[model samples]
Target: MFILVGITDLPWLQKLLFVLVLFFYILDVLGNIIIVSLVMRDISLHSPMYFLLANLSFVDICFSSITVPKMMVGFFIKNTITLQGCLAQMYFFHFLGCTEGILLAAMGYDRYVAICQPLRYGTLMRNTVCIQLVLASWLIGLTTSLVHAIMTSYLPFCNSNRIKHFFCDVKPVIKLACADIHLNEALLTNVLGFLSTSTFSLTIVSYVYIILKLMKIRSSQGRSKAFSTCSSHLTVVSLFYGTAMCTYLGPSSENSIEKDRIAAVLFTVITPAMNPVIYTLRNQEVKKSLKKLIKHEHL
Candidate 1:
């Protein structure tokens, strides 16, 4: 039988990965903290769009925290993780992901309501409605992760003990199952695919309508001004969906390790770090409010 080995057996590469992972998470934390602080402190940002943006920033913070720190510690400490650690990591990892996915959809809907139904934006996304959406997103997050976790735990891991990457991603963990995980694989792929993709497609369609509406504006200045508002949101959406969908939809094999890792780094590491900067820097209203706040404080 061929010997099965993992990163624990390869010391040097793990150290390098550890440094890179820490750097990514540190950036994510710093950027997200700035966003949350700005949103909470600035009274002018108490609208639906900024509120959703704030919640999105919060989700990204929780999402990255789920995996990065443990990997950093694992690098200097024992490379091995306990079964309990594996399960906990898997739970929070997937849980935050599901929550973020739903929140992204909610964000898109918020944008859609703002752009397409401008007259009713306030009435449509009132405080009670926004709170309900946030609560529902959390509920969906826990429920989806619970299903995946219970399924993963019951699967027999008779032959191998090593997880492919730094964390216990569902796909990599399921691959190690000695039992036939084909059914579980199919269930996960189909359900999660529809969940993520349906929302993604809706987001794209919503933006298409938004751009169409912007083009109808009489003045070139009006059009440019309106389209500029969408620039950051569109960029964040593209980065997130592009990387995440590729990882979930693309085929995986031993030979695909490099590609998968690149996708993982983009989806889990880089994208979270980018969200806060994108929101704050691209938003004129936010920048104005922040500048005014700093000026007042200095005065």
Candidate 2:
């Protein structure tokens, strides 16, 4: 069995964090569920962009769900997790995290098609194409995470089994292994770096094309209208990538564990909770659909 150090050692702080995190978890689940339901139920949202957004929301919920509730339970309990359980947590966390990264890139490409190649958007981002993109993302994520989990499971853990984080994240868990983990560390860095860098490059390249296309539009209104459609996606990408890079790609040290914990909260807990608000507030179509749903319920 492995013990989780959790977010804090303070009794008072644990209680406080438990309540705060629980509230956010509930909000995250509810908000994402609403987005998914809205996309499926509303005919107006039956488009490639909304289809991707709904999938992103679903990823956010699952990603956060994998870690947050377990962390919350640790706040008030012994915080012990078995070896198998720890491995499972680490696997799914990376699985969803990687999937979200790829999905964001795909979404960026979808926006690029919608904005830069509007004439061919229908042909490029057809429903079949969007479905394939999502499936590819999931498959890639699953394969990468499976390798990490299997490799880590082989490491000999003869030392202390206490993981100094709220959950069984790769870095913290690997720190407990008695065997030489240079290979493990290298794998973690290379695999995660490749996934993050490649997907991020795709997203950035798509946005670069989008921005250049927007620049050529003579009318300010037309440019703003085009940019508005992409703003929410950009915001979400920023939030996710910024914190994730810090946690997985930054220089590692004894002191860095605390920083990793903080970064983990931002990407896992905070980002998921914020996604629904960011999309709904910035997305006119989503807001319109929500309002119509409310008005219909009243009638």
Candidate 3:
């Protein structure tokens, strides 16, 4: 299917956007790679939280790769994707996006156990359990995305193949189908809603309890310390869920393409670029480990 991407008229605008997109893409890849490297090598960062965080960094790397590279190409070359290529992109986009959603929830739960159940944190979130949780997140992502991708890829595309928005978003892709897409719509709205909402709900519940537990700490220092551990996660969640919900949760209106595209950029591209920065800058332990890793590499 031939996909037209971005503002086509103004060459100047496209050039500017290409540079911006390339810059963000570079930042996302480099920052997440550093996080993964530091987390893996630093003995101090081998805990459950950092373990989940490393998985997140890896997810961010894959997630952005699914779309941003193609987007960068859109500015320079013929902005067309083959049917097979579009289907592949759609599948992996959902796969990695869903994985990141679940992993974020897992991270939230990790923080909950760390702060709320400090006494039993060891038994509750053992190495085996952490591995199980990580595996389950990927499994769920793969299963959910495979089903949706199969269903979507099979839909007859007799209509025009030009996708309205950039990339192979489910909604935009579905709109191109000439066949009655009620089922697709239902699945997109209800199934995706269920998947995203469920994980988002889990994250919310975890943080709610974490906040309540922090409130009980009598010492101001104690409360601050507990809150500090989770502040970065909360900020990341807000950025991710904010743009994601706006993009996916609502009704698909025709006029919302520009809005959707902008929101999509924030959700898919900018958020991933910012995640490593948010985690590393706000996290003292990560900073320390990063410094040590840099020094060791230099030596």
For model 3, where is the 10-residue window of minimal lDDT? Answer: 1-10
Best by TM-score: 2
Residue 292 of model 3: what lDDT? 92
Summed backbone clashes in each candidate are 0, 0, 1
Q: Quote the RMSD, in angstroms, for model 3.
A: 1.2
Best by lDDT: 2
- lDDT: worst 10-residue window of model 2: 246-255
Off by over 4 Å in 1: 1-19, 293-299
lDDT (tens digit, per residue) of candidate 3 on 162-189: 7877788888888888898888878877
Q: Candidate 1, residues 1-299: lDDT per residue as tens digits? A: 11112335467987787778778788899878777777888888887777778888898998888766765666676546666677788888778887887777787788778777889988999988998888998888898888888888898777777667766777777788889987877767776787779878888888888888886789999877777677888888888888778776766567554466567767787889988778778889878877886798899
Model 3, C-alpha of 261: deviation from truth (Å): 1.0
Q: Single out the weakest 10-residue window by summed lDDT for candidate 1.
A: 1-10
What's the TM-score of every candidate structure?
Answer: 0.90, 0.99, 0.97
Model 1: lDDT of residue 223? 77
